[model samples]
Target: MAALSAAEQTVDTEHFSESMHSLSSDAEAFPADSAEQHDFVVDFIEKEVGSDLKSLKNVSNLLKKLTDENNVLEEQVLTVSSSVPPKVSAALSAAEEARCSLEELLKKERLISNMLHQHLQGAQPWMDNLGQILNQVDHIERHMEYLRCLQHIEELSAAVQQCLMTSSVWEAIRAVDSMAALDTGLSQSACSHLQDFLRETLHFWHKIIKDRLTIDFEKVLTQLHWPIISPPTQSLTPTASSPEISSQLELLVTQLLALQTSDDLLSQKDLASGKGGPSAQTVSLATPTSLAPPLCLPIQIMLLPLSKRFRYHFFGNRQTNTPNKPEWYLTQALMWMGNSTTFMEEKIQPILDRAGADISARVELCRGLLSLVQEKVASDASRLLYDDALFSHLVEEVLQFEKELRSNHSYPAALPGLLHLLLEDAVLQKWLTVERKMAVEKMDAMLSAEGAWSSQYKDISDMDELKAPDCAETFMTLLQVITERYRALPCPSAQLKFLGLQRELVDDFRIRLTQVMKEESRCPLGARYCAILNAVNYISTILSDWGDNVFFLQLQQAAVSLGDDVVLRDLGVLELGRLASLEGSLFEGLLALLDRLKGDMLGRLLEWTMREVIEKARPYGQDRWLSLPSQHDLSTMTLSSSACPMMLCVRDRLLHLHQSLSLSLFQLAWQGLADRLNKFLYQDVRRENPQKHCLCFYDLSPTSLNV
Candidate 1:
């Protein structure tokens, strides 16, 4: 068996070697051979190594097992080599895909992180701003609540104080300080309600104050006992006051006396220091103390509460236990006249005197006197003849005083009072009529030569340029006085007489104006003449209404005739175009007259005057007039043995007329003159020259032409 085994081993070895060769030579071609060879190797090993032979059999079993294990390993290797490579490739691909996905996911996460960072970056500022805005809203609401609480408390305190002061519930306000103290604790809602309540309360209080004032004023009026003159006396009446109250009053009086003394000292010091001089630092500082009294007694009287006892004593029914009495105001006036005469005479009269006894002073004095008169008239006592007599005497005395002061120009202050007094009294009106006549005569004489009107005219003539002075303002003042005086008289005859006088005055004025116009026409240039004409026209226009009276109409006609002569002179200059160079003065006169005349009258009069001027100027041809040389040639050229001055006078009269009636009239009259000239040329053998137009006279003989 060993030998056989050896031989088999050699054969097995050879087969194994041959199989190894074939496997090495062609690994792919041996699929059947490889399996068979693997099985054969296993079978040979199992056969050669029988189980009986212990060590050898164990070696053969181990070799055979090792060969079987090798074959299984080979199969596993082949399967692993083929499947594992594909599986490994798929795993590698999947792993690569997963890595790529992870990379993409990381990139997406990075992108999302960047967007979140950007969003957070944008949101941070807004969040911070919102936080700041919310903080401010919390602050404003706190202050509003504080103001509302203060107003409510003020109203409550006022109501409580008002109830405490007077039993009648309508007393003067006493404790405003207490009311103001309550303003701190009030809420907003309470304050609004309190404000409304307080407004209504204030209105109520204001009405009460007014009623009280009226009652006091009425009581003052009732206490005056008119028509009864009495001397001043200081009588001490018993007072119902405790000793302490009396002591307090005494102390108050002492303090008031001290204050008065101090005030007097200060006033004296101020007067001595010349603080009220014209050169003082301020206007108030310059005001004289005498002009404005230190004590305002009238206003103080108005402020005092109504005296109930005085009202009961005076205004009560006469049939009852109450005594009949006069008005308090009259009584007060009497008392003031007696006791405060020094105040009125020393302080008030000095102011009135310094006011220059002018119309304004008179007006103020009249007002004060009238107030006293009203109080006297309102008194319940019987009317006193002495009072009426005293008023009349005062009126007469003031009038006489004014008259005496008139020459000194010191009565202007008194004139207003005089006028008012004249209006107030019928007797004064009658007195004024006689006085006015005397005044009128005196005024007429003064105004005749040295008065404002004549002086003004004389002054105007003395000026470099002769102009009619503006007498309108002075005339207006005269008219105002005359009108007022005429109105004061109740008689229609007197008014008619005044109207007649006014008409006469206006006629005289018109005559003077006409004379002025005529005199002005003698001026070489029409400028001064035209200006005077305009003044005349202005005066004529103002007095035109006077012409409505038949008597005045005749005067106006004469004046108009004189004006016509002036107008004629102005027209002559205008025709020569001399007035055009006169600085528009001639045209100004005509325009003034045209404006003054009513439209219809102006049109008609202007047309008539223009026609007259045109007709008169027709005989003097333009060429003949143009050929006449200026004043320089007057001595050398005696164009005609004619009175040149007379001709000049006529020419000047016509020129004046033309200028006084404005150039507008001439322009209207010359409207168709150009066309008429063209027609005349066409009929009269007029030919147009190349350089200049020429006219050929066909019907002219040498003798007829005087050539």
Candidate 2:
């Protein structure tokens, strides 16, 4: 048996080796084909099964297992196959019924499609006819509207003409306005010839009504002798026109206002350009009808006579037209307004009141008069600026006139047009130069004048404080004059320029004060030093007060309109700083001056007092305490008259300073002197004294020291 098993194992090993060689050959020969793999399997089976009976037996058993599984699969297939026939028959029956239903539905769809096609074909001509009817209706409506617009325009034209003939100014203006509205209401396509005719008719009536009202308005004004120019010497009231003239003038003005409609003008322009209709139209110069103030034409008409008179007197080579005397015409303009404005308010204002016009009669008259004044002033200013004297005089007069106009006549705080000519950069620079030169001259004269530092002492009242020197008082007065001159300047840039000039002058004044202080510092007398300290303190207080003043505040606010973080950069003194900052700088500089002056004065006071005390103690220094007193030295035991003189000298100096200096300043000096004297006597005097004589502090009375 062992021999048989070994033989079988040898055979199996040989056969496996052969099968491995064959499979390698098959894989190399046919890597992707199944035929090579099948042949290899057949060769292996034939070799292995034929080589041993046991292999054959294993194969036979496998074959029997496959046969059993095939039979089972066959039975399962038979079971499934038995159910397929009935289900297929049922599906066929259902399909046959669905086909019949689909045929019926298709027949109904064909019939419905034919009916819809027929209906659409039958309605085609009716829809076409309806579209044509709609077009015709639109045309007819537009034509009717056009005809109605033309007819309304004709009616308004006839009504306007009749109203004008009947002197019905208000009715005529309303009729004219209605005609304008109709003309603007029609579109550009509205019958060209008819539109041309209506426009011509409207223009004719518009011109006639306007001309007639203007004529009647002027006639009444002529009767009242309008724009009566009053002389400076004469009173303000003009020759009074009767109530009847005023009533007529009011009616004419009301008619003019009623006829004016900014909306109609703008709409007509839009229609001409084919741009917009009434709803889309916009006014350029004025608001829509009745919302804007009435046009200034009527007031301008009343100003015609005055304009002619002004041109005659100020524009030409007349004796009164000299540039040297700009105030003649400027003042005349103001005077004319003064005379006519009141009359306009009392008489013509009622017309606006009854018509519900939102405007001031006085303002209207003033503006008209100022327009003429502005032109005259500008023309003369351009020529007169070449001559400094004449220009200065002109500026002075203009300032005076502005002051009177605002203070007395209730004009605005500033009027730009009135001062616009003066706002030019070149003009401002020249003006600033002139002002600075004049200011310097004034300052020099003030400082050179006698008693400039004198106190102008008066008996002391409870309310009175130490008086400032004449120089300080006059300097502030000079500042006031400069401030008032530019207070009413209208333009922000111009006001800033003036502010720069003021700051420059302030710096110049500070320099002058410093120089004066230096000159007075060397003097042994304390009066001038006291005066200098008081002046600085006084001027500093004045500047602080000005910082809070409305005038200075307004100047500071005016600089804001330049829309800059910094302004007047060219002016070094005010570069990139506000008026308030410059004010603070000025106050700080004065304070520094005050500190330095106070310190130096105190030192000088200490030195002078100590020198006098030493002089009075010189005799005591000679008579040394080294010698013992005799037995009858009772008089020496009492306080010596020598020490009394030194104490008296110190007391007199303190009293003199108390009377000379201001209270606050005197208190600082006294306190400082006390400290220094105590230190000197304790440290310096004792250290230098070889004999170590006992030092004595005098019991100075408070009443004598004025402490």
Candidate 3:
């Protein structure tokens, strides 16, 4: 309006200026309450315009008269009237002054706007940030509302309690749920109030449902003396209508989950869990046989603590920070599973695993576990139900069960329920897959041509390192590391499966040994024996750890049998050679190896040696192989007694063996071997297949077999 008034002033004065006749319209458009000033301006304008108008009329009459008279007279009249109206000239001059002032104001305003634009450029970023801050602040009121509501938790708790007391369950549920909608930690005072509220809620609900369930539970303990698992509520399926679940147990769990409690209150629930009643009567169980063990408690008593644990872990106040959006019912449905697992492993499994545990007890325990599991994890037909806890429990049960069975040196009963439980859980499937992978890994580690350098893999040389973690390892050697690893492994049934895999590896190792022995070279035979000894000892040593696992016992027996077969099959050559290389001696029983060699490789080698002796003697022109002259020299035949050092070594070894053995075992074993060889030499080498010469053993053997 100022700019417009200023522009109007400038235009009125500098451009086609308006006459005073429009002043009345201008006054009305620009009204003011200054009556004195208005009257003054009106008087001044009337006085100024009055004379001008009188002069103009006189001039106009004079011009008309003059025009009628003469043109010169008209010009003179107009000049005289213009001079007579000086006040009107003063008013025109004031309007010109106002226009000039407005022009100055416009120039100053332009200058100020230009300066502000420069500063505004620098301030744009701050302005933009301020805008964003204002937008974010829009939620401040809502956050304050939530905080205010949080402060009122005590009041809300009171309201809920009142609602519950009045039997307005829906109102109580709404009140509690509204409290749940908030996600904030409470002050200690408020938290205590909340815990009080939660306790009241629990007390109220328990007041309604306790008597009914207590009676049922007490009757169950008194009569059946076992867990009376409620039939599972059908999980949410499209075709199936919801099962009517008014059972006191379900109601107790359901209502308890709807409130808020402190961590301490959550830990304190026993009466609601059915433990306040009298303890179940214990029956005297018949003592188990030597093979089977007995459990520590009867089934009802065993499940009692578990029942309490489940009630404690599950059926709690909906936590303050817990998510409130998910389908809470399905969560409540699956809630017992995790509690059941903790209860079974911590409370029940130990009893079943105790010494002298009876099968009947295990059966009852399994039944309880299965029933509890089915009731919680399997009962839900809801699509949203997740039973990961179920798989973890079943895995622990099967693994621990097998471990107990193996430890007691007893077998397990067929549990079709366990199989079905495992079969339904995809987690169990994945667990089995991981177990299989570990088994394969162990076997590959065993069979790999390369040795394990790190402690992670088995190294035959690092027996102590291998034995380090093998606390319960029964194996006397490096194999105990594997047993320990498998035992510590998390996969269900992995220890037994891994032991079976070791057995397969052992079979493969034996086959490899057989293939190696088929080679004709003797030099490679020594290295082969070393490899065999190392491999067999590596396994056999670990298999000695029967304290933890019974399966290692089987491997130990197999390893011993393999050792015996390899030693006797080689006729103590490999064994004696190995012991000799290591600067060790054979035991007294190794002399028996000589007997095992008869009619085998050692017999053929012996027959070939006698023929070589006969031929060497002929070349010596000593048709004298019958007996070495006590003074005979081997120089002529390039051998003493015409026998190779290997033969003489064998001969000397036999002599030593005979000297060491008493007459009985030595004759029963190697004496027969020597007699058969001598018979072959005398009958076949001397008469039939060799030159007729007296082949003599007097230099190396006893008189009876010297031939």
What C-alpha lDDT do the candidate models reach, one value each?
A: 0.41, 0.67, 0.42
Best by TM-score: 2
lDDT of 2 by residue, 511-552 (tens): 787777777766534687777777766776677676677766
Q: Summing lDDT over every window of 10 consecutive residues in candidate 1, give the lowest-scoring window.
A: 691-700
Better of 1 and 3 by TM-score: 3
Kindly give the stretch of ten consecutive residues in candidate 3 with the minimal lDDT sum: 279-288
User: Per-residue error at 13 for model 2, in Å?
Assistant: 42
Q: What is the C-alpha RMSD of each candidate to the true structure, in Å?
A: 32.7, 14.8, 33.3
In candidate 2, residue 431 scores what lDDT?
79
Which residue runs of candidate 3 sit more than 4 Å off their true CA positions? Answer: 1-398, 401-437, 448-524, 530-623, 626-641, 644-647, 651-680, 683-693, 696-707
TM-score of 3: 0.28
